[model samples]
Target: MSRELSTRANNVERLPSIPDNDTNLIFGEASVRYSKGRLLGFVTDEYIRAVRSQRKSIDGFFKALRELNSNDAKSLLYMKNSLDDNSHKNIAFDNDDYKNLLIEYLKDHPDPLQEYNDLIYYKIKNNLPEKYLDWFKKDLRCSLFLAFLVKKSIENDVYKGRDELLEEVVDYLRYDIEIFNSDYSQNLPHYRWDIMKSGERKTADILYIKSYYLKNRLDCDKNISWVKPTDNEQINWMYNYLDDKDRKYIILKGMFFPQTINEKYELILASLDVLSNVESPDIGTKDKKGFSLRNYTLYSMKKAWDGRKQYEANNFLNENSSVKVTKENQPKLKKLMKFSGFTANKVINHSIEQLYDELIVDKKND
Candidate 1:
């Protein structure tokens, strides 16, 4: 038992002591040492006066130091054993100068992706240079990162003052959609379209919706089918009911015709009109006046039309005389058709012919 105890003591004494040198340190300690050393040598000091006096010489030194090999840097970095509080105090004073020098070096050597990552890390650690946080969020690495930054800003309530930056990000996302239109073949418009439809950006959303709606309308005018206010008994009933409801005033001209045409047109037009009118209204006005009616109406209309379009495009293959549309003219339509399991070419000719017929009828009436 005594021998065992002695052996254990011997093992304990044999345990390695931590190296005092930075070069032989573990990663965590090395990081701390590096940060502390940077703070001491470059961050604080009469270094500011020295830097001003020998600005060119200091820049040359920094350039040389930056260019040094790994072994040389490790040797020089490990040379310092300890730092005093006065060193820290001096670092605090020289913080701006150090930051400016780093910024100039980074600017002259532009690496957007890496620089963005470094800025984020530094901002999280040192809490220096409040402007760095703003710049980090604005850096255009990926839409995913911008989205994360936006969400984080929202959580921190930093979004209020950063509206311009948010706008820039949204614009970048818009451009990305345009550039990579084919990659989103499954839900091509749905990605950017839904973002706009959320009513987050009133002007931008309205403009996009209007643009998409017009483009779709031009693609398959036959599919459009404007209901003519004929002498049909059912048509008269719907017209009277819609008119008496005081909702007819909100309907665009020629939007309330026959059941087949009126159904989709009224659905789309009503949604757009209501959404356009009520979006971003005053809070009291939105609540007290019940502008939420428009909001709900728009939502329901969008859902109904979207679902119906999907259903029609899906069962189109089983139908006798259905038409298929192409990507260039009706990109979203093709996606909807493909999602619905319709053969691509089956609907093209028939759909185009139907659209042409509708145009003829529309021109005659007009």
Candidate 2:
């Protein structure tokens, strides 16, 4: 998913999946079905903005719909007429008629995913050709070319706008130039604090905010928090370690910023190490769900990564065949680790490989 999200801009004319192949790399390394769903959720900036401008809110639009009570046919007719009448506007709609424009006029506009579902229904009802319909039906491309034709057909009673829409849709679609750039961070391996800043000498619990360039690319800020030390002595030891180093400090691995899931901020840190004498719980504690807190932390880290990048991380961990036991030995190992008094909080601190390593050691000792 990260690969698809990262490379989406370059795939404007491409279909996200192949009819025969079931899955296509056009959407980037993922299952065919998953990629198709993702493509369906994406919309060109033009389409969303147009739909959004047609209405102030979803509630407002629904109110209008209730008033009109027009069937889909009449609604489509009105929408077609409105598009033709308002050619001068950037979005092809002037919102002059609420009865026809109610769908677009809602106070809470439909999300792209919703629009995708409707579009699929439209395609099926019309019995569109397999080649033209499969992208929406089975692939992720939701071809703007075909979408424009659908609109044109409703207005003109002919499907002759494919070429015209293809040319224009490119301008309306949202494509980040960064996605095409080789230097884009999403193109590379994920930002693992320890591995990324391994060469840096200092560790930082508090990081500085530098920029928002990643806002558009990531859809949010990236800064996260460090795992808090349980004791004041451990905290002092951590600060002392930072003070001793001239190198930039990194944050702890297990914790994240309170707003990491919601906000977007560039975090400036490499990695950190707390005092050795500080007794922390081992990384094997389970939550109420019985999964390791470490597993939960890893899943959270996966959330921070773009979808495709998360796959990359998963692949990287999976490549270590020696750690196969982690996947193989599960419930028995969980009980053993619980008996060892490992805390869920402690488990979140280690990487999957480290966790498996610990498991292997404990298994041998037994």
Candidate 3:
């Protein structure tokens, strides 16, 4: 990331680029897509976003959308047989099926996405018709649920009660399923559980609500622990701060980088973190909520490197410098401690006395 190394690092693999003008060179497919999205105002700004692997996140949304589009009745439900109440396989669902479906996509894919797949599934169950989908209500519910979690994230991790947090989720989902049956979430009817007793509950596989029902289904004095995978966009954002790639690359190929225009530099994602950065530079901005647009300027090795650091310093510096990923997450925690320099929490932190002044402040604003 040092400015001095930009020349060699910019096109280390001898990758080609496309000249957009006297200055910029489109590096990869992502850069191309990002350029278009940003030019049109789809992307908010150029900064290191909280998605470590934009490709994976992009693919997840695509797969989720595809899953929603599938007319296959069986695909809609993960058959009750596929998941058992207390069985080992049921408790630990086969994540591989879902994981594979979300990989192999280019990072700055032009495809749209929705992180609320599970939340949406909770709304209508498996009732998405072959056409005429209404995204308004489900989007609202997702927004509310997301806002609640964001508020929780800012709270002191200690004072937070466990079940109270979950109760809020169930309360939202349990509000009569018909609440989302309309095109507008604001138009939802009053909270009610028994709108129609005989209505089909097939799509009622809503997570927290399902947990809410488990208690009613069992007569024994048992405490049901409803566990849901942490795939929420917020959680993934947190993960990106620690899990980002150690280095970014800029080798370009494909149509964007050809012949005479192949040597230009474009500022894509977080260049210091991951490469194989394309116009959708292996290093570019990726907001999980919308377009993974790559922002750029006239090409220059120094310019690209500086722009990349400027962005990273603003968005990801604190998360990268504050925690003990080197200690806690590392097997060397105890042994590294003997050196007297090791200090911090399990993640990018358990504590922060030794954290640098840079980690806590939002440098972009100041």
TM-score per candidate:
0.20, 0.18, 0.18
Question: Per-residue alpha-carbon lDDT of model 1 for 2-46, expressed as tens digits?
Answer: 111111111222333332332211122223323334321222223
| Winning candidate number (lDDT) | 1
Of the two candidates 1 and 2, the one with more favorable lDDT, higher being better, is 1
Global lDDT scores for all candidate models? 0.34, 0.29, 0.27
lDDT of 2 at 286: 58
Task: List, residue by residue over 144-219, the lDDT tens digit for candidate 3.
Answer: 3322223322233221222333333232233323433322223221121222223344333233232322222211
- Ranked by lDDT from best down, the candidates are 1, 2, 3
Worst 10 residues of 2 by lDDT: 201-210
The model with the greater TM-score, 1 or 3, is 1
lDDT of 2 by residue, 1-366 (tens): 011111112222232222333112112243222123422222234333433454212232233233333323233333333334642332433334433454453222325223433433432333212222222232111222123222322233222223333323232221111121222232121221222222211111001001111111121123223323233332343334343454223232122221231111111111211111112345323543433332333344435334544554464455444344365655544444344433322333344558777898778888
